[model samples]
Target: MQNFLNLCNAVIGEDYVLHEPAKQAPYLQDWRQRATGQCLAVLRPANTEQVAQLVKLCAEYQVPIVPQGGNTGLVLGSIPDQSGTAVVMSLQRLNKIREIDTANSTITVDAGCLLEAIQIAAEQADFLFPLSLASEGSCTIGGNLSTNAGGTAVLRYGNTRELCLGLEVVTADGDIWHGLRGLRKDNSGYDLRDLLIGAEGTLGIITGAVLKLYPKPISQGTAFIAINSIVQAVALLHLAKQQCHANLTGFELINQLSLELVHQHFPQYQRIFQQARRFYVLLELSTYDNEQVTKQLLEHLITTAIEHGLVEDAVVANSIAQAKNCWALRESISAAQAKEGKNIKHDISIPISQIPNFVQDTDAALQLAFPASRMVTFGHLGDGNLHYNVSPPCGTDQDSFLEHHAEINRIVHDKTDQFGGSISAEHGIGTLKKQELLRYKSPVEIKLMRAIKQALDPHNIMNPGKIL
Candidate 1:
């Protein structure tokens, strides 16, 4: 172990190799603080070349490697295990924007670049990178791609996988694959780029990527609507799509309890509606037309929905500041839930048509089993992903309530499977969801996944206990 450490220190400067407990503390835990791991060391490489060299040394010594980015993953994918046999390879120092090709409508960036930084760079170039997340200020692009993260803009821009054109990766055997080509069409053979993506760093370590960009919208509109039920919300979504067409970029569904939690924890964010309804939809539209045209279209859509009895009441943002404040309410749900207490979180997705029924059935089943358990349900309605979470009954002990984690997960995930929905929508299967993945996937599917893992990482050293 000492010999391996010496070699790592030699490849990257001694200062970059963090072996002290104090120095390695932050990288040893997950974003949610659900679990803390122990590592032999935390290695920070400045560039792709140094990463390759460190990986080669790790391969030579048979030491496991955990490729981490910002350490912001909810699952325990980016951290090492309690065995303390693995080393965390932090990509923090590899922060750079390699190039921006306006003609190709792509930006090549290092793995460690912050998501917000990339968005700002794209805006400066007079283009739009529409990958917006609540954690945009902290999370890195590498983590986003590795998890194939889905945010609000997924309805229009799609997930990180769809946004990426190519990737530069370091294989398990310590060989660099320079596959960063910003080509929209390449039908030569199997797509290695897509394989490495969303693999949770099990196949290879993503070092860099070429990401797609878009022209900025000429006009934007945001609205908050109060609805009677999930059924009505779904109907309103259909109506909005018909009226706004491709201009409808976002449609988020927020249950009453989620809004109450936000109000309770963050009183600064004023509510848009005076009276609360069972559910709320934070919808947005972006178009190439002017602001007046956008406003007129939104007013027309709202009027039509109200006439159809789909919307009880709605408030459209009259200014940019108002639109931002409307978004702030939607973005504050997760944090409010955290401030309330620890809870079981499920990032599931079902067919859009089945969502209303699925929620009704699941909510009833859960209430019957665990009475008074708060359901903080909300997510990207347009794309069919829901962050369906459960807080303990009022006055119940958070840790004690968590003792029913396995049972709660079973209730939710089984229904998800029954509805033909994915157990994990945006989040990848780290150690947290590995068993669930096994139970949900068929024998043939699991076998194929394992075969690919074996072929790409024969040594079982690239994030060994992740997705597969």
Candidate 2:
């Protein structure tokens, strides 16, 4: 460990290597408050070359290397194991917006650049980099790309995997793969850029990427509506899609429990609707028309939905400020839940058609198994992903409730498997979902994943014990 630390310090200077326990403590834990681990040192590399060199040195010593970005991941992919044999490679220093080509509609950015920074940059250029999330302010593009993050915008723009054009990666063997072309169409032999996108840092370390950008919407509108059930929410989504078409940018589902959590934790947000239903849909409309057309269209859609019995009540944001406020409520769900108490989170996805049944069955099963638990469910219904979380009952001790995490996971994940859904959707199978992945995946699928890992990282040093 001492020798490795000395080598890292020599390569990147003493200021970049953190060995003290106090300074390393923050990097050892994940955002979920789970899986704290120990590492010899945290190394900060400034550029792709530095990253390549660090990987080479670690590979030479047969030491495990964990590539981390922003450290906002729900999974323990970035945290080292308790063995203290791994080195945490922090990519924060590599942040740099290389270029923004308005003509090609692409933005070249280093992996360490925060998602919000990219969004702001695109906005400044009068363009849109559509990959967004609640953690956009802190989560890095590298992490987003690594996890292939799905956000509210995925209904229209697609996930991180679809938004990326090219990549610059540091392979496990210390070689750099510079495929950062801003081309729209490339019929190449293999889409290597995608292979590393959601690999959870097991295949390689993403240094930078060329991301796709779209024309900024000239007009925007937002609507918050209360629905009777998940089935009604799905029905409304289908209706909205048919009516609004491309203007329907976002369609999210929020439950009453989640809304109450937000209202209780974030008092600044004014609850718009008087009555609370079982579920709510926060729908957004955007178009090229820079006049009142967008608002008129949104209002008409809401009115139609109400007449069809799809929506009980609705409120359309009157101004840009109101739209932002409405979004704040949706974005605050995760944080509000955190402030309320400890809970088990599952980011799962099912077929659009099966969502209603999946939610009903899972909620019923969890209720039967853990009678006192509260299910705070909400997510991008348009994309079939739901943040189905199980919180401890009111006035109950969080620690005691969390003790049944394993059993709770079995119940939730088993239900997901039964419905042909994924245990993990947007989040990758980092350490958190490794066992679930093994159990859910077919033997052939697991074999293919292992074969790829062995081929790319024969020593099993790059993010060891991850995905596979």
Candidate 3:
């Protein structure tokens, strides 16, 4: 370990290597605080060459290496293991915007750049990079690519995998793969960029990428609609899609429990509708026209939905300020839940057509199995993903409450599989869902994954024991 530290220092200087426990502590734990591990040191590589050198040295020594970005992952994918034999490589220093070609509608950025930063850069260039999330302020683009993160804008722009045009990666053997091209159509034999997009760093370390950009919407409109149930919410989604067509940028479902929690935690932003319903749909519309077309379209859609019995009541944002306020409510769900109590979160997804049935059946099953639990279900209804979470009953001990995590996961995941859905919709199967992946994935699928891992990282040096 001492020799390895000396080599790292000699290669990247002493300031870049953090050997002290205090300095390395934050990188060792994930965002969930569920897994804490020990590491020999945390290396801050400044560029792709430095990353390649570090990987080569680690591989030569047969030492495990964990590539981390932002350290905001819910799963322990970015966290090292208990062995204390791994080196946590932080890509935060490699952040740089290499290029923004408005003609080609592509933005090339370093992996360490924050997702929000990329969005802002695109906006400054009169374009839009629409991959957004609650963690955009902190989550790195590399992490988003590694997990293929899905966000509310997926209905319009698709997930991280679809947003990426190309990637520049450092292979396990210290060879750099520079495939960053901004072509709209590439008839290559195999799409290697897609392979590493959601590999969670098991295949290679993503150093940078060329991401797709879109035209900035000249007009935006938002609405908060109250509905009877998940069934009505799905119906409302179809109605909005039919009425608004491509302008329908987002359609999210929020349950009463989730809204009430937000209201209780954030009293300033109360319900926007005049009357409360069993569920709510937060819909957004965007267009290139700066006229009142957005507002008119929203009102028309809401009126149609009401007439069709899809929505009980609705409120459309009158101004930009109101639209931002409406978005705040949707964005505050995770924080509000954290303030309320310990939550068991599941990011699951199913076919859009079967979402109504899945939600109804899962809610019933969860209520029966955990009578003392309070469920707060919400997420991107347009994309068929939900952040199905459960809050412990009042006065339940935190440790005891969390002990039922396995049981809760089994119930939710089993039903998701039955519906041909994924146990992990957006969040990658880090250490948190690694065991679940083994359980839910078929033997053939697992074998293929293992074969890919062995092919890319024969020595198991790149993020060992993760996503395998």
Candidate 4:
């Protein structure tokens, strides 16, 4: 172990290698405190060559490696195991913008670049990278690609998988696979870029990528519309999409419970409607037209939606600040829930048509089993992804409530499966969902995944015990 540490120290400098527990704490812990891992050291390599060398050393020693970026994953995927034989490789230093081709509408960036930094670069180039999240300031493109993150803009642009043009990855064998081409149409042999984008670092470490860009929105309008039911919200989404067409960028659903929590935690964030309703849809539209025309179009849509009984009440943001504040109300849901109590989060997705039924049945089942449980449901309605989370009954012990995580997950996941939905929508099958994935996926599907893992990582050195 000492010799291995010495080799790592030589590859990246002693300053870049953290051996002490105190120094490695930040890299070893997850964002939600759901996981804490112990490792021999946290290695920070500067470039692709250094990363390849470090991976080669780990391969030689048969040591497992966990590729982490910004350490903000909710599923504990980036956190290392407690075996102490693994190395947590932090990719914060490889933060560079390799190139920006406005003509091709692509931006090439190192995997370690923060999402916000990428957004800024795209804006500076008079383009837009639509992948966004509340944690963009700290989350890296590598983690985003590894998990195939989806955010508000997924309705218009797409998920991380769709936004990516190419990827520069370091495979388990310590060899660099340079597939970073900005071309949009390349139906070559195998699509390796898609394979690594959402592999969660099991097959390889993503060092860089080529991401697609879009024209910046010249005019935008945001609104918070109160709805009477989840079914109404879904219907509202359909109507809104039809009315706004391609300019419809965001369509989010927030339940009354979620809004109450946000109001409780972040009092400064202005409330959406004057009176609370059963559900709210935080919708946005952007186009190349002027703000007045966009705002008027949004107003007309909201008026029509209200007349159709899809919306009970609506408040359109008059300015950019108000729009951001409306988004703040949506983005603050998770944090507010954290402040309220321990929650069992389910990033599940169902067919848009079946969302209303899934929510109704699941909520009823959970309540019938545990009469006191509370559900906070909200997410990107346009993409059919909902963060269906459970909070323990009021005044219950948080730890004791957490003990029912398995049971709670079973109920939610079973309902999702019945609806032909995915148990993991965007979070990926990290350590938290391995057992669930096995239970939900068929034997044939699991076998295919295992064969791929074994083929790429024969010794199981890259992020061992992750998806497979």
Candidate 5:
């Protein structure tokens, strides 16, 4: 182990190799503090070449390698196990914007670059990088690509996989695959880029990428609509898609309880409507038309929905500040929930058509099992993903309620499976959901995944014990 550390130190300089326990403490723990891992060392390489060198040394030593970016991942994918046998290869030093090809409408960036940085760079170039996440400020592009993250703009631009045209990865054997060509179409061979994008670093380390960019919208319309139920929200989504077509950028579903919790914690953000409704939709539209045209289109859509009895009331933002405030309310749900108390969070996705039924049946079943438990359900309704969570009954011991974690997850996940949904929508399955994956996935599916893992990572060193 000392020899291995010396070699890694030689490769990237001893200053970048952190072997001391105190120096590695920050990277060893997860963002949510759910778990803290042990690592032989935390290796910070400044560029792709140094990364390749360190990976080669690890491969030669048969040492496990955990590739981490930003360390903002919800899953345990970036952290090593408790055995302390792995080296955490931090990608933060490789943060750089390589190029922005205006003609190609693509941005070539190092994987360690911040998501918000990329967005801002694209905006400066008069283009738009539309992958918008709540953690955009902290999350790295490499982590986003590894997870194939879906965010608020997924309804318009798709997930990170869709936004990326190519990737530069350090393979398990420490070989660099510089396949970062900003091409829109290339059917010559197997799509390795797509394969690595969502592999959660289990296959290889994503060092850089060429991501797709779009023309900046002339104007955007934001509206908050009060609806009766998830069914109405789902209906409103369909109607908005029809009326707004490709211009529809975001459609988030927020239940009344979620809003009340937000207001309870953040009293400054007042409710948009005086009359309380069961659910609300934070809808947005990005169009090439001017502000007046965009406003008119939004008003027409809301008026039509009201006439059809899908919405009770609606408030369209009159200015950019108003629109941001509306989004702030949607974004504050998780923080507010945290302030309220501990809760069980499930990031699940169901088919759009079945979401209403899934919610109705799941809520009833949960009520029957754990009476009076509050459901904090809201998510990107346009994309069929829901951050369905649960809070303990009034005055119930929060910690005691958490003891039912396994049972609650089983109920929710089993119902998700029954409705043909995915247990993980945007968050990838690390060690946290590995067992659940085994239960939900078919034998053949699991077999194929394992085979791929074995084929790509014959030594099982690249982020082992992750999804498979």
Candidate 6:
């Protein structure tokens, strides 16, 4: 152990190697406080070369490594194990925008670049990087790629995996695979770039990536609509798609409970409507065309939906500030839930058509089991992903409520299975959902995943005990 520490210190400078408990504690624990771990040391590597060397040394010494980004992951995937044999690798210093090819409509960036930073960079170049989330200011692109994160824009831009065209990775044996090509059409061998994007760093460490960009929208339309039920919301979604066509960029669903939580926590964010309905949708559309046409089209879509009884009432943002204010309501859900109490969150997805059935059945089953629980449902309705979360009764002990996590998960995940939905939609299978992945994935699928893991990280040193 002493020899291993000396090697790491020598390679990454003594200052970059952390040993004190207080200094390393932040890296070993997750942001949500649901997981805490112990590590022998936390190593900050500045670039891909340093990462390759550190991984090589760790591979030779048989020490495990956990690649962490901003430590903002909902799952405990980035946290180290309690054995203290693992080295936590932080990619914070590798923050750089390598290239921006406007002709190719792509930008190459380092793994540690913040998501919002990338968005700003693209905007500076007069392009758009549509991958966004509530944690855009904190979450790094490396974590986003590793988890294949999805946000409101996924309905139009797709997940991180679909946005990425190439990747640079450090294999478990210390080899750097430079696959960062900006080409859109490359019929190569097996798609290794796709493999590393959503593998949760269990297969290899992602160092950099080439991501797709789009033309900045010249006109934007945002609206908040009163929703009656999930079925009605889905119908409104279909109607909006037909009206807006490819210009529709976002379609989000929010429940009354979620909105109430936001109202309780963030009073300054005035409600979009005077009277809140049972559900709501924060929808958006954009186009490169003139603003007048976009505004007229938005108004027409809302009018048609309201006339059909699909929407009870609606409020369209008349100004940029109003649109931003409307967005704050959707972005504040997670923070509001945290302030409320202990929550059992399920980031699951199913066929877009079955969402209504899934929600009705799951809510009924959960209500029968725990009548006191509150279900806060909201997500990207266009892509069929819902962050269906349950908060314990107002006064239930946090620990006692957490004890029912497994049972609560069973009830929700079982319903998800009945609807043929995935257990994890965007959040990867970190320590939090390992067993769930096993139960949901088929034997052949699991075997194939294990085989790939063995082939890339034969020693099981890269993010050991994660994903597969």
Write model 5 residue lDDT over 289-322, tens digit each, in one string. 9999999999999999989999898999998989
Model 6 misplacement above 4 A = none
The C-alpha TM-scores of every prediction are 0.99, 0.98, 0.98, 0.99, 0.99, 0.99
lDDT digits (tens) for residues 1-468 of candidate 2: 678678888889999899889999888988877679999889999999999999999988888999999999987888999999899999999899999998899999999999999999999999999888999999999999999999999999999999999999999999999999988789978889889999989999999999999999898999999888988898898988999898899999999999998999999998978787888999998899964998889888888888888888888999878889889999999999999978999999988889999888888888898897899999999999989999998898999999999998998889888888999889888888899899999999999988989999999988998887
lDDT of 2 at 151: 94
Off by over 4 Å in 3: none
lDDT of 4 by residue, 1-468 (tens): 889989999999999989888999999888998789899889999999999999999999888999999888888899898888899989999999999998899999999999999999999999999999999999999999999999999999999999999989898989999999988899978888998889999999999999999999999999988888988988888888888999999999999999999999999998777687888999999899999999999999999987887878888899889999999999999999999978999999899999999999999999998887999999998999999999998999999989989999999999999999999889888899999999999999999999999999999988998987
Task: Give model 5's TM-score versus the native structure.
Answer: 0.99
Ranking by lDDT, best first? 1, 5, 4, 6, 2, 3
Candidate 2: regions farther than 4 A off: none
- Each candidate's number of clashing pairs is 0, 0, 0, 0, 0, 0
Write candidate 3's Cα lDDT for 1-468 as tens digits.
788789999889999899889999899988867779999889999999999999888988888889999999887899999999999999999899999998899999999999999999999999999998989999999999999999999998899999999999999998999989887789877899989999999999999999999999999999988888888887888888888888989998998888888888998885686566788889999898774888888888888888888888888888888888888899999989988988899999998888778878887888898776888889999999999998888887877878999998998899899899998888999878989999999999999989989988999999988987
Which residue pairs show backbone clashes in model 3? none
Clashes of 1: 0
Q: Candidate 6 residues 83-134, lDDT tens each?
A: 9889999998889999999999999999999999999999999999999899
Score residue 238 of candidate 2 by CA lDDT: 90
Worst 10 residues of 1 by lDDT: 459-468
Model 6 gets an lDDT of 0.92
Residue 438 lDDT, candidate 2, scale 0-100: 91
Q: What value of lDDT does candidate 4 attain over all alpha carbons?
A: 0.93
Better of 1 and 5 by TM-score: 1
Per-residue error for 289 in candidate 4, Å, reads 0.8
